[model samples]
Target: MFGPEGPSLRELAVQALSSVEHGYDLLAPKFDRTPFRTSGRVLDAVARALAPLGPFDDGLDLCCGTGAGVRVLAGLCRRAAVGVDFSAGMLDVARHQVRAADGPAIGWVRGDARALPFTAAFDLVVSFGAFGHFLPRELPGLFARVHSVLRPGGRFAFPLPAPAPASDPLFWTLLGFDAVMRVRNALWWPRFVMYYRTFRLGTVSAELARAGFTTELRALPEFGRRADGSPRVRLVVATKPTTQQGS
Candidate 1:
């Protein structure tokens, strides 16, 4: 629906009718062509912001999806960069998309984010545009999963845009989309779960805190400030405490 190479409307309809996992599996090959892939501009801004926070040894890109975030990791991290996703097709694209000069070796692992397979292995972790696939109730478990993979004092980060107000057309557009998806799920099996408004800042911060990470938001100046002077984009930086033992 985005460009000549992007999926057509009929193909999108077929995807929307499938379960979330299966839908992504079906869409994986052309996913990067669609507008859904995180943009190069956003990726560059994120990498620039994260550079000061690094010298990180290893980094992981959760729900990597065609390796957009993996590129960011390859630039920020020194030793290795890994991309994890459930779709093999997506991983295939990532394997090819991530061939830059000499840097951390790029690795792709096919796995679900809810049950990641690692323990204190990554010094930094990042995700982009995949949160809507996760329902709010899953945040605790998901955050815990991320926590288990990060080294102590390591940060799990992502960029979050401020919610659109009711006055904005984007607000109603997202609301309508969520409502339609709910109806689609009610009539369909193996539900697809993606909602725009579900993961607000307050709920996310609380979940991160519950999962044992102290979280903060860092504004990305590259995206520029909004009309009211608030940042257009902010990075949610959640840090696992240095001492894992009971405080």
Candidate 2:
């Protein structure tokens, strides 16, 4: 769903046909007006979940998009907050839009998430709604990049909602969306690469472990629980080890 300020159907179709970076560039101007931007409620929930574990230093927002996650980092990190994304257009919008009045100084860098342009410079890293762009096979490298950027004992965190049950319409909707994306990728030139079903908790945890992170899951109580009494949403906090270990 989009607002009056959001991209039109024709504009969306055009974006769908373009490569991921270029598509996001085209959408950057109106990204905040669309459902694609991470919601304020979700941002607040993640911030609340991360607050206790922090007193963090510098923070990096991987694949920061229009810089929503950077806003969260600004409040939590004591030093500086940096947002990195491949899309120059998105970074431009973020530079103009996101501002921290008093907390941390904010900076923007344009770089690929797979080959992030940083070392162990960050005490915390956060990402929001950007994983679906990465294929399942890319998880290891992606996690590794996040790990590389973090200082020892640093955290890479993001919120993940519980998968919908089979009986729920949302489940089918996501399934259908993934199915359509598969077909589109198969038929199109530059694949859009957004899928709803690929990222799973079990797989992600294992990958995080392989990438040298000790992972933790903290339930976001604001979203409540499912009928089965499991959390409706969780914040995945993957911490880089304080000491070196054989990979």
Candidate 3:
């Protein structure tokens, strides 16, 4: 649907009608060629933001679609970097596409994000452009899963673009796209979940706090600022506290 090398319109329709996991499995081979893959520019910006903060031992890319986030992790982590995703096809492609050039050892695991297999094992966790697959109600459990897998003082980071203003055509474009998705899910079985506007940062920040993260936002100047002087993109830097507190 995106380009000549990308999936066709019919192929995208078939994917959208399938379950989210299965749809990604179908799209895996062409995923990087499609615009659906996170941009290298964003990845480089995130890597720059994170590089100064770490001499991290191990890192994980949650919902690591084709291991794009793993590239950033490889550069920053000293020991190892792991990419975890539910789709075997995606992981297969990731295993082939990502390599450590004198960087950390890289590996891939197949798993669901809501129930990650590890516990307090990673020094850093990062995700790129994978959050919309999760519904808003799932935030608490999802953030808790991230919190549980990270060691004390570890950071969970991802870039979040500011919501488009009402005057912007892209704003309404996303709004209309989400409306169509709502109708699609209502009538379909094995619903595909991807919504651009549903993951609100204010709600997400509060949920991260509830999940025991001390959350903060850092402006990604690479994406530049909005006319209102706020950043067009901000990195959500949610840190697990160094000392444990009573649950």
lDDT of 3: 0.93
- The lDDT of model 1 is 0.90
Alpha-carbon local distance difference test for all models: 0.90, 0.94, 0.93
- Summarize candidate 1's per-residue lDDT along 20-110 as a digit string, tens digits: 7678878988998897889888888888888998889999999998898988999888899999999887888888878857998888999
Question: After superposition, which runs of candidate 2 have C-alpha atoms over 4 Å from their true positions?
Answer: none
Q: TM-score, each model? A: 0.96, 0.97, 0.97
State the weakest 10-residue window (summed lDDT) of model 2: 238-247
Report backbone clashes per prediction: 0, 0, 0
lDDT of 3 by residue, 186-208 (tens): 99998899999989998999999
Model 1 residue 103 CA deviation (Å) reads 0.1
RMSD of 1: 1.3
lDDT of 3 at 190: 84
- Model 2 lDDT tens row, 160-209: 99999999999999999999888989999889989978889999999999
lDDT of 2 at 104: 92
